[model samples]
Target: MSSMKTYAHVQAKTTRWKLDSKAIDQGIAYGLMIAALFVTYLVH
Candidate 1:
């Protein structure tokens, strides 16, 4: 029974971690794209 509880706890933690990492990855990609566009416009 204790092992099952531990497994559940780890599962929940990893799921949350995955979601947070996914959000971070998306944010970084968006920021990089915006920066690239801004640099291109500035060269004009």
Candidate 2:
């Protein structure tokens, strides 16, 4: 259908999703906390 083709074209033209610096820093901090907990559990 024409509608389906138009929708596909619009979707293809959309910009890629992005992660900003603040989000990346928070994710890194969360991952580090989980890693520390896992290491502590193994050491006990």
Candidate 3:
């Protein structure tokens, strides 16, 4: 019974981590896009 509870807690923690990482990935992508645009503007 204790093992089952621990398993549930770990599963929940993993799911939360996945979601947080996904958001971070998206933010990085947007930052890259903005940087590229800024560079292009500077070049032209």
Query: Residue by residue across 1-44, what tens digits does model 2's lDDT show?
Result: 99999998777656222345567888999999999999999999
Model 3, 1-44: lDDT tens digits are 99999999999999999999999999999999999999999999
Weakest 10 consecutive residues of candidate 2 by summed lDDT = 13-22
TM-score of candidate 1 versus the correct structure, residues matched by position: 0.86
Candidate 3 colliding pairs, count: 0
Note the residue pairs that clash in candidate 1: none
| Overall lDDT per candidate, in order of appearance | 1.00, 0.81, 1.00
Q: Give the clashing residue pairs of candidate 2, or none.
A: none
5, model 2: CA deviation in Å? 30
**Per-residue alpha-carbon lDDT of candidate 1 for residues 1-44, written as tens digits (9 for 90 to 100):** 99999999999999999999999999999999999999999998
TM-score of each: 0.86, 0.56, 0.82
The segments of candidate 3 whose C-alpha lies over 4 angstroms from its true place after superposition are none
User: What global local distance difference test value does model 1 have?
Assistant: 1.00
Best-matching candidate per TM-score: 1
lDDT of 2: 0.81
